[model samples]
Target: MSPRRIVSIYLPHFAIQRWRRRRFGPQTPSEPDPIVLAREGHHGPVIHGMNAAAVKLGIEHGARVTDMKTLVPHLQVEDAMLEADVRDLRMLSGWARRWCPWVRVDGKDGLLMDSAGADHLWGGEAAMLADIRQSFGKAGLTARAAVAPTIGAAWALARYSAEPQEICAEGEIAEALSLLPVAALRIDQDTITLLKRLGLKTIGALAAVPRASLARRFRHHLALDANPPKRLDLAMGAIPELLDAKLPDPPLRALRKLAEPIEDIDNYAQVLGVLLPDLAEQMDQRGLGARRLALTGFRVDGKTSTVEAATSTASRSTAHFAKLFESHLERLDCGFGFDAMMLEALVTEPLPQSQHSLSGKIEDGIDLPHLIDRLAARLSPEAVLRIVPQDSHIPERAERLIFAGSNTDAAWPAHTRLRPLRLLDRPEEAEVLYAVPEGPPAQMIWRRRTHRIVKSEGPERIAPEWWREKSQTRLRDYYRVEDSEGRRYWIYREGVPDDGRGGAPRWFVQGLDA
Candidate 1:
C-alpha cells in the first residue's frame, strides 16, 4: 500500500467571498471597492474579516470599525455572520468528499482530506490539487491547496506557501518546512513573538535548537498548538495526527440521464416506468419501503419540475407506485424538455416480507391502502381524510380528521352507549322551555326554530376532567331526544340550577344521531 497522503485546502477570504456570492452571483468578479465584515464588540463594531481590496487598504481584522472608517471613508461594511460561515464551510467539506472518502473541516476556513491512494483517479497529486483549486474558483472562492505525507505539513504549506498549489514529496517535509516562518507551525501569536525574540524566526532555526532546551521552554504549555516542538513533530511525521472525517448519509435516489430531452408526458412516464423498478429493487435490498417518493425532471433550460407521491403504508411495489404517480404526471411542467430525471425516496419505513396467496390474489377484502393512495393522488392528499378516534369522553374531542396516508393502528374504543353519527365541532346553544330543571327538555329552541320533545331518554351526567379543566367548570347532563318531526339530537345542559358554578342551567345541542 502507498504511504498516506493528506490534502489541505485553505480559504483565506472565505467569509467575505461567501457574503459576496450571496449578494451577487457565484461567478461574481472582484470589485475595486473595499468590503469588510464587522461584528458587535464590547467597545464597538470590530472587523471580523476583509476582502482583498480592504486588506490592500491597510484594514486589519479585529480592528474597531469606527477607527477603520477614519482611514477609508467609503468602506462597504456588513454585519458578520460567523455561524452561517461555519455551517457553509461544514457543508462544503462534506461536498469535498468527491475527491476522497475521508474529508474533514479544518479550523474555521479550511478543509482536510485524506487523499491517500485516491490521487490516481484524478491523474496525479498535481492534477488533483489543480482540480480542487479550479472547482473552488468556479464557486467564486479563493483556494490554496497543498498535499503532503503528513496532515500538519499539508496544512502549513496550504496556508503559508508562496504558490497557491503546493505538492511536498514524501521524505521532503523538512526541506519544505524549513524556510517557512515559525507562525506556519500554527502556534499562538504570543509564542511566535516569543520565538522571534529568541532569534528563532524561521522553523529551521527553531528546529536546530537542542530538544532538551525547547522541551524545557514549553513543557508547561498545555495546548498542542501552543507548543512549537509538538507541532514540528506532527508536521515532520514524527507524531501521527488523526483526522476526524465527516461522513454524509447515503442518498436513497436513482438517476437517469436521457440521451435526448423528453418533451411529452408519455415519454416521461416511460422514463418513470424504468426508474420505479430500479428504486423498488434498492428498497427491497434494504428490506425498506418508501412512505413518500419524489420524481424530479431536470429540464434542458436548467430548471426542475417535481411530482411527489405518498403511500398510506410503506410500499415497494413498482406497479402500485407507478399507478400513484400516473395521476400526477400531468402536473410536471416540461419546460424546454427534460434532459435528466431522478427518483428519490424521501421517507421510508421497514417492511418485512409477507406470504402472498397462491393465486396472487389479495386475501384481504379490499386493498384499502392502495385505493386510498389512488384517490389521494387523483384529488388532493389533504382532501382524503380518516377520522381517528381520540381518547376523550367529550363529544367534541372524541375524534379528529387526519390525512388518510398517515400510518396509525389506534382502534376506536368500544362503548356500551351509542354515540352520535355526526358530532359538532362546538355545541350550539339552545333555550329550553316547559321542562323540569333536573329532567329532560320538554321543548327546545335552536337556530330560531322550535322543537317539541316527542321522546327522550337520557340524563347521563358527565363530570369535568378536573386535571384538565378549572375547578369552576360545570358538569354536563346529556339527553338523547326526538323532536316532533322525528329529528334526533344529542343535547346537553351545561350546569344544574343553583349548582353554584354559574346561574341557571344553559342548554346546547351537541350532535345529531343518525
Candidate 2:
C-alpha cells in the first residue's frame, strides 16, 4: 500500500468568523474594526476566540472581557456560538471531499484529510492547498493548510507556520520540526514548562540531550520516542496506527435509483410497489422484521425529503409496508423531482420462521392485529387505543386506555357484578322525590323530566378508599331501577341520611342500561 499523506486544515478564527459573517454579511466596510467572542469561562466571562482583526490589534484570546474593553474600547463583543461553528466546520469537511474522500474532524477547530492518493487529482499538493485556502477565502473564512508525511507534523506545521501553505518532504520531517517549539510534539503544557526551564525549548534541543539523562531528570510523561527522527519515522508509517481513517458504519438500508425523475403520486406509488417486495425479502433473509421504517426522497437538486412510520408489530409483509407508505406519501415534498428513493428499516426485531397449520382458515382467531395495523397507518398510531382494566374499584377508574398492542398481557377483567352498558364519565345530578331516610327513591327528576319508579333492586354500597387519595368522596349506595316507561337507570345516593358525615343526601344518574 502507498504511504499515507495527511493534510491538516486549521481554522483558527472559526467561531469569530462564523459569528461576524452572520452579523455583517459578506462585505465589511474598510477593516470593520475588530471582534472577539466571549463566553462564560473559569474566571468569569472571557474572550474564548478572536478574529484576524482582533489579533492584528494586539488583543489576545482568553483575556477578560472587562480588561479587553479597557484595552480596545471599540472592540465588538458577541456571545460565543460553538454549536453553529461545529456545524459550519462539518459543512466545510463535506466541501473538502472535493479534494479527498477520507476526511476527519481534527479537534473542534481543525480538519484532517487523508490526501495520500488524491493530491495528484488536484494537480499536486501545492495546487490542492491553494484551492482549499481560496475556497475558504470565498466563504469569508481564513484557513491554513499543510501537507506532510505524518498527521502530527501536518497538524503542528499548519498551526505554527508563518505562511498559509507548507509542505514537508517525505524523509526530512525530523529536520523540518527540529526548530519548532517543544509544544509541536503535542506534549502537555507542564512538560513544555519544565523543558524550557531546563534550557531545552526546541525539538532539536530535546533531541540533543542523552535519552537516559532526559528520562532520569524529568520523569514527566511525553510523546517522546528513543529519538525524534525514529518517532517521525514511525508516525510517517514505518509502523502504522492500529486503525487510521475509520469511517462510520452505514445504516441498514435499501435504495432504488430511478432511470428518470418521478414527480406524480401515482408514479411514486408504482416505485414503492416495486421496492417493498425487495425490502421485505431483504428483511426475511436477515431473520429480522422491521418495526420502524423511514422513506426518503432524494430530489434532483441535492435536497432530500423524508417520512417515517412505526408498526404495531415487527412485520416483513410487503402489503403491510405498501399500506403504510401510501398513507403518509402525501406529506412528502417532491421538490423539483425525485432522482432516487430509499427505504431504511431504522428499528428491527428478530423474527423466526413461523409454523403453519392446515386449518381451513389460516388466520383463525385474530386478524385483529392486521386490522389495528391498517387503522394505525391510515390514521396515527396514537389515535388507535386499547382499553384495559386497571386495578381500581370505582367504575370510572376501573379501566384505562393505552396505545394498542403495547402491553401483550392487557385484558378486560371479568365482571363481578352487572355494569351498565353506557356510563357517564362523571355522575350527573338528579333530584330524588319521595326518597325515604334509608330506602331507594320512588321517583327522580332528571333533565327536567320526572320518571316514576316501577321496580328497583340493589343498594350495593361502594365507598372510596381514603388511604390512597384525599378527594371529596362520600359513601355511595347504588341502585338499578326501572322507570314507569320501562327504561333502566343506574342511580346512586351520595350520602346516608342523618349519618352527619356531610349534608343531605343527593342522587346522581351514573349509567344507563337502556
TM of each candidate vs. truth: 0.55, 0.54
Which residue pairs show backbone clashes in model 1?
Answer: none
lDDT of 2 by residue, 1-514 (tens): 7777889899887877778787778786424578788989887889988877888888877789989999899998889988887888777777777888888787778889888888898899999999999988898788999988878788778987777889987887777777878777656666668778879888778778886776566454444532343343344456554315446444667799999998888888887887778778888887888888898999999999998877777878777778878878888898889999998999989877674466645466446666787788776778899778888888788887777857468567787778899888889999987555868789989999999998888898999878776566678889999999999999999888777677888899999992
State in Å the error of residue 110, model 2. Answer: 1.0
lDDT of 1 by residue, 328-386 (tens): 89999988899999999999999887767888787684478898989988888889998
What are the lDDT figures for the candidates, one per model? Answer: 0.90, 0.80
Q: Could you give the C-alpha RMSD of every candidate to the true structure, in order shown?
A: 12.1, 12.4
Off by over 4 Å in 2: 25-31, 218-243, 248-253, 256-514
Lowest summed-lDDT stretch of 10 residues in model 1?
Answer: 432-441
